[model samples]
Target: MKKLITLAAIALFSTASFAQTTWNVDKAHSKLQFTITHLAVSDVDGIFKDFTATIVSSKPDFSDAKVSMTANTASVSTDNDQRDGHLKSPDFFDAAAFPTLTFVSTGITKTSANHYKLNGILTLHGTAKAVVFELWYRGTITNPMSKADDAGFQVTGTIKRSDFGFGSKYGSPMLSDEVVVKANGEFSKAN
Candidate 1:
């Protein structure tokens, strides 16, 4: 009986580790981008320069993936400090109250062969909203640099700025009502 119990314990540990995999953010190969209306006209493009995400998955379908990302609010730059400051102020992001925006995937549904509906809670400005992004599987390959299996994805969505209480300084026609979010992420599967 003791020998059988010891065998069971070893089997449990081996199964747990083998059934789960962790991927570190390949930041160099990943990008988080956004676009917003400038003067309610042309789109102003910007990106977060510093951020990282850790993903754990049990299958290639990402059926059991737990993802968490952190972005430095100070890393936002739209090529103008005055405009960036205003964005970081209470008018828009209120960066002080909400230093970082984050999302955790609650469910993943396969919509088509290459498309998925990623349901997650997007927390911004101390408020949480249920957001679903249309994600497309960009396939997988072996990374030449790291020699690790790499997976790629593209997701796009939009959210209203007023929903997060950032409409005060939107100032009529100068600022837009919605913000466009685009994410292109690549992860290196840990060996």
Candidate 2:
């Protein structure tokens, strides 16, 4: 009976250790994008080309996962060169003063089978503010090319530009105060 109990304890410990997994964003297959209403009549889309993200989970369903990401402010691009340059200037993101923006998850609440409310602190324009975003765990599968487990996720949220203390000069008419954030990522499980 003592041996049976000992074996059971060992199995539980092993399973707990094996459950912890780390996933790195596959940059080649991931994109971080945003959209803002321009002149209150049109929408302008942009993307951050240089960024990195990681996820750590101890459950296969990722119910208790922790996520973090960093993006270079100067990497903001809207396809148009002149507009991109202005975005990096002091009038907007001020890439010269604040070189990077980051987000670190503080909590996660499951809303459905594959959807969750992700709460985190987003630091941008030298200000840090708590934000909540919708997270959708697309699912996991074995990648044919990498021959490893891969997971997909989509995150969407809306943040006020004034919340971060940037772009105050431009009102809603010229540049909408609300910015729509969207990101899609394919993460590769690290060995």
Candidate 3:
């Protein structure tokens, strides 16, 4: 009987080990994007060229995670040179004074099999605000390019520009004070 109990315990421990693997954000292939209203008739989308996050998980508890991200504010690209320049000026992100937007997660909770909620503070434009993003695990695969095990996720969240002390000069009826942010990133086992 004691032998059987020991065997069961060993099996459980082995299962736990295989369930989790470390993932490092492949920043070169990941992207963080934002969209805001423009002129009340169109939408301008921009992407931060560089950003990263760390994700960890355990079986049945995807909530076990540590996420951190750093983005270059000056890398904003709207596909238009002049507009992109304006977005980096004092009237908008003011990239000169506030060079980066960063977030470090406090925790992550699995709301359901397919949905997750991440609690973190977003520091943008020199102000910090507690923010939550609804995140979904897109799935996992073996990357063809790197021939490595990897996973991907999509995270969506919204915050009032004013919440980060960014809307004063840029917000108006045409350019709404509300902005939406999205991140689509993939991570691979870190070497």
Candidate 4:
């Protein structure tokens, strides 16, 4: 009986060790940016200057990966001081009330050898909604600069600002409902 209990404990620990590996975002090599049409005429671009993400997976293909990220709302910038201020106000993001926007994956499905569909819930403006994004795994490499194992991925998606409580209250016609978001980054495997 004692031998059987000891063997069972070893098996459990081994399984847990092989079940999940965590990766940390290499922020210097990552970006969280977006673009939106201005007044149905020109394009306006912005980025979240502060953000972080974690990726955990049990498989080499990352089909079982869990991803989560958070971005500081006040970090949004478009190169125009006045416009940036307006975006930080209650009329837009209400950065003071909702200081951060976050997303946590609910599912990850492999679409091809290197492509995947990431389904998750995004919380913004104090509201949570389902969002699906496309991700392309760019494989892994040993970084020439850091000499560390790094994995790369690209993500693209669109979300309606109005769906998250950004509406006509702030003369919404001046801004489009849909915001195009993109992120390409390398993550380092955590020890």
CA lDDT of every candidate = 0.80, 0.96, 0.82, 0.90
The model with the greatest lDDT is 2
Name the lDDT value of residue 173 in candidate 4: 65
List pairs with backbone clashes in candidate 2: none
lDDT of candidate 3 at residue 41, scale 0 to 100: 79
Q: In model 3, what is the error at residue 190, expressed in angstroms?
A: 0.7
Off by over 4 Å in 2: 1-5, 8-18
Sort every candidate by TM-score, greatest first: 2, 4, 1, 3
Clashing pairs in 3: none
lDDT of 1 by residue, 1-106 (tens): 9999999999998787669788877888798888988776699988888887877888777756677777777677788889889878877667887788888878
lDDT, candidate 3, 116-168, per-residue tens: 89899999988898999998887778888888878888889988998877858
Ranking by lDDT: 2, 4, 3, 1
Best by TM-score: 2
TM-score of 2: 0.94
- Ranked by lDDT, the better of candidates 1 and 3 is 3
Q: What is the total number of backbone clashes in candidate 4?
A: 0
The true-versus-predicted C-alpha distance at residue 126 of model 2, in Å, is 0.3
